[model samples]
Target: MSNSKGRHRKEYHEPKISEIEKLVSSFRSAHGHDKLMDSLRSILGEKPKTLHKAKKEDTKGSAEPKISELEKIFQHFKEIHGEEKLKQSLNEATGRDNQKPHKKDKTKEHNIYVDREIKFKKVKSKDVAKDIINTAKSFYGFVREKLKYKKYRYPAIAISILMGIYLLFNLPLLYMRMNWEKPADTQKLIVKTQETVQKKMADSATLAPGEVVPAESRLIIPKINVNTPIVYANTKDEKVVQDLLHNGVVHYQDTAKPGEVGNSFITGHSSNYWWDTGKYNYVFTLLDKLERGDQAVVYYNNKKFVYTVRDKLVVEGSDMSVLAPTDTPVLSLMTCTPPGTSWKRLVVRFDITDPVFHKPETVTKENVVEVPKEKEKKPGLISRFFSFFMPN
Candidate 1:
């Protein structure tokens, strides 16, 4: 057993010098074959032999130096990673801080509205007192100005009072003038004049056929609702005759006498006065609507002459030929055309039918009979005089 043990120990013993040299040669062949010495010289800044001596001196110290170098390497790795992560974390933190200040400023601005309401309440008492004093001062100044102008105010009041009184007195007259009165007195005068003229006409010894007496007459047209008194034809007279025949009176120079043949014409003022209420605004409005068979009656010398409407025509006023006498025994009523404008004239023509004379003795037909001499003149001068005041 001892001999076997001795052989085993020899096999596991440390290598000899020659064996170590062989092992080193093998290592150089495998790992340090290409520029191994030059690589070592560059890292150490010396030949491999010099580096070995320096390594031997460094090994003479305790293991603590080697351990500290190892610790330093590990610390360097930790510092590098820590610095990178810290820098990234610091950048994120800075971004959050900047956002926090912006949010704080917004909150401050929103709260200012509440501050303003509180400030306004503090100012209200002083402002109200100042405004009240300013208003009182303005009103006082206005009252003083009114007192200074009192002299002018009195005259204005007096003038207004006088105007009111004048208007009150004139109001009734204005109303009466505007309305149409029946003129019964004027009708009576017209009837009396007509009786006298007929009596004279019948007594051939006293009057000729063409001779015309200066007597007033009246005309009535029931269809047109006209019952106006006729006045003597005088261009100088400025009265409005009620009926169409009175209108004929104005053109007496160009028209036949009330008893004669040929066209008898008349003219009158239609409107345009304070008294005008448009009542006579269209006196001929109904006249223009008259048909062929309509009757137009004329009263003169207490007699009635009935005529039938024949034709109607509107012509420019410049064309006066329509007013000229026609051969037919016709009565023509002429008025300004267009009612309001005198630019034209309307002429209505009528054919007379039966001509009758009414006297105190009898209502006779066209033929006049001779009466005995004992009868006083039927229409005396008194009747004629009273007729002058008639409304026509």
Candidate 2:
């Protein structure tokens, strides 16, 4: 019986007293001597009064005795609970060793996540660029294969080149038109130009009865930044009017003059040939920017007439009804549609403010907004060139 008891003691005491001292030293390093004493007191189930007395003694230069008390407590717990159980209890009581593993685990997970995100972003960007290049190559190859036959090859290539050239010439003009800004002095320019025209006409007041003001007429539409002369053409012939457009925007001879009791028809080039010999070739390029209630001021015959836009329309180039007479006085402004092409006509019609031309119709069930459908018409190249000067 005595030999069996000694063997049991040997097995249970495999960890020696030195191991206990080392564990306490490491605990003290991790949590400080004060926390180590508190944890030891907690594990030993010491009374709060006794722990308080010990802390007061520690402040009185008795720390060595307090450490000895902790050592004695450790020895007692070691014998009662076995060495392994005592070590486990110490780790639980200190808590730093258990918490260290969790912190390391969290740091490792964060590093892995960040690395994966960086690698995925780099790979995704490369894949996207490669896919784009491959798609463009495949499209090019497919088009080339379809046009391999002699019958289709030359026409396909010619059309592609022509379209490219057209875009190259027209895109800048379109951009300029879309981004055009009104200058700060645009209003001043309008007032000053009208005054100058009036002063000129007043000086030439001693002319014949049928003579008009000496052709110093100006047209000012503030919305599109237009301040250009109004060119009067004697004839409605397409060729003659086209020639007159080089000087400025043309007013049809048959149409009513500004402030007259009829439609005052005016047309200008939205965009002309690249080498067109005039500053006003691109004057009305942004005419499409006008909306209802916008203003169009015409300085003519020693007078200034301000017209407010009432209706806007985009009609086929072949449509002549827009040029017909109206029951009320109106100012009709015409420009080639889509800026650089003569596909259609964008008309901005305005009601004369003086002597109030727009008679308000009573609101009815039919007064709901109506959107007009655009009619498509493909004018021949000859008509396209003369579309800017279309007759009233």
Instruction: Go through the candidates in order and give each one's C-alpha lDDT.
Output: 0.52, 0.70
Compared with the true structure, the alpha-carbon lDDT of candidate 2 equals 0.70
- lDDT, candidate 2, at 325: 83
Q: What is the lDDT of residue 277 in candidate 1?
A: 51
Off by over 4 Å in 2: 1-215, 355-392
Which pairs clash in model 1? 186-390, 194-301, 194-302, 195-301, 247-266, 247-267, 248-265, 248-266
Q: Which ten residues in a row have the lowest lDDT in candidate 2?
A: 191-200
Candidate 1 lDDT score relative to the true structure: 0.52
lDDT of 1 by residue, 162-206 (tens): 978876787765445444333332111112122222232231113
User: Highest TM-score among the candidates is held by which one?
Assistant: 2
Can you list the residue pairs that collide in candidate 2? none
Off by over 4 Å in 1: 1-216, 235-251, 273-282, 356-392
Estimated TM-score for each candidate: 0.32, 0.37
